[model samples]
Target: MKSVNFKKKLTRLFFVLLGVTLVYQTGRTFFLKQEWQARNCAYEMVKLLFPDAWDRACDQYGLFCFNGSEKPMQKCTGVVESGSIILIHGLDEPGLIFEPLALALHRKGYLVLFFFYPDDQRIDASSRLLFNNLSSLSLAGPVVLVGHSMGGLVARHMLVDPVIDYAGARARTKVPEISDLIMVGTPNHGAFLSRFRLFMEIREQCLLASDHRWHRLSGFIDGTGAAGIDLLPQSEFMRHLNSLPYPGDVHCHMIAGHIFPFPVNMPEQFQMTGNQTLEGLLLSEKNYFLSVLGKAGLLIGDGLVSINSSVPFNVPVTLVKGNHKTMLANCFSGSSRIPPAIPVILDILEL
Candidate 1:
């Protein structure tokens, strides 16, 4: 009789959870489609910030270049301005996604160098371009690197593996000394969702659709590009990147969010050390797909990245209560709440 009663409760709980997952997925799918299908607005934002850069926008491959007062695509011969902050965006993101954050830093008197890269370039390739670009900057002062998602991967490579020259691409000069590394919702480990077969296929195509030829001819990076390959669970790039320890010479601060509202009453997978609060990181549902995937000892994280993935092996983790996207979106006016990371970064950098 007790077993029967317990099963009934379990069944009720399952339906409640199912309703929550469905609602979240419905909104999530709409958001994903909106991001991928939306037209690129890179130029408009740049023009809004610097009216002079408006005409130069058309010349740039995308909409705008952050070379700062320099003509598009021309060699940036300017000295690296002091109090400069380099911002790199994550996968399926544009430099403008960081507008709010940049505005906040600007108010604090920072010269923001926003970097834009292909949506699907591998870490190795992305880092190579970054290395080449930074090598030429000839910085006049120390700089802080702020990376979101895969952006952290590029910054990490700069710290521990600057010599990676993919496709025979090499750094012409040494990258400037990095004072601090700040990562928000970065997947130091691969995301579990990247392993999903259907999601993988769709993501691969969306990545491929971003090509100039694709746009002009009406076309994208699959998940196997120089960058996408690294996002998969336990992929070769992840293993390689994680193999290197966090550089002791530089301090890296991290921030992440948990999606679920309830924690103490959640599933077994949501459990944390010493029954720690899972408020900042845990998925809401544990359906068949989650159950099958959870068997590999998967964890509850910010819905996109597992906590095990966000919390670097040796580096510290600061849990910010939110989701994967919102944690780094403190800069967005619509984002409303201030991201926990912004304060941490400002404090560390003494800004």
Candidate 2:
């Protein structure tokens, strides 16, 4: 008839103006998430009245502490202190940036638990809370794992689950303790700004709406396993953290970041493809070694680790100042300049 009733009145006026612009952008994202939860509850009451004054740089840098209790073979303030270090911050961060690298590994005496997870959950409940706190804690020898940025993929699911106390020792006989891991600025390989956050999710907020792995990490960093390491198995959180198997002789490392044009500059082809150095972009296979340092000279990092991924597996990595969130928020804060990575974790755990 008359142009089919004016194209059904312009397709019901374009879905009624797209349903009133999606209800005024979901009521302005619920009042901007209630004003960012009232400004993080007034920045946790001014960080409990001005704390973080180099909180004794974790006892001049040695670190130590365990404490977890509520009954269970008590006595855990660093089981006869000597070897123990655990810190896994990232994703929304806070837990006092490992209190000055756990007071410098509790002043060289070691033992520094300092925990906290559930940064909006996933990665299988944060790798079952790091394999139930490393098979119900008591570790004091080889255990040294650190994280930052999805807490280094939840400390690589304690080396890809050779067995980590499955939901309370599922039927016992599966205890993994975790040897050594360190990852900062993470991204394993798949965060090239996630396609500018999925093109700002077509605006009006809901920018990837709290991550469903941003379009499966923009289709595994645009496929072909090169950077975006083929989006680690379409990420069920990096395919259960790339199904482990790299723990042989532990001591793995992959610290990356760059702040060049921006994404905070850590991309020399993502530090040469996370140090796997291109050839088919290696992710893991027990073979470890990747150290790419920086400080704005080689396109800075540490604001999230960028000198080709804060190298340190086969050792040799330095050059600090600050970035990657001002190296855990306080390398002597003036709100970012440099000087703090707790003196490079006390010169890389001094040995």
Most TM-score-accurate candidate: 1
Tens-digit lDDT track of model 1 for 140-203: 5677888887788877876677365321222333556667888877888777564333454454
Residue 75 in model 1: lDDT: 30
Model 2 steric clash total: 41
Tens-place lDDT per residue, model 2, 246-305, is 556556655444344322233333223324533223233232222222123333444433
Provide the RMSD of all predictions against the true structure, rounded to 1 decimal: 12.9, 20.0
TM-score of each: 0.62, 0.26
Pick by lDDT: which candidate is best? 1
Worst 10 residues of 1 by lDDT: 214-223
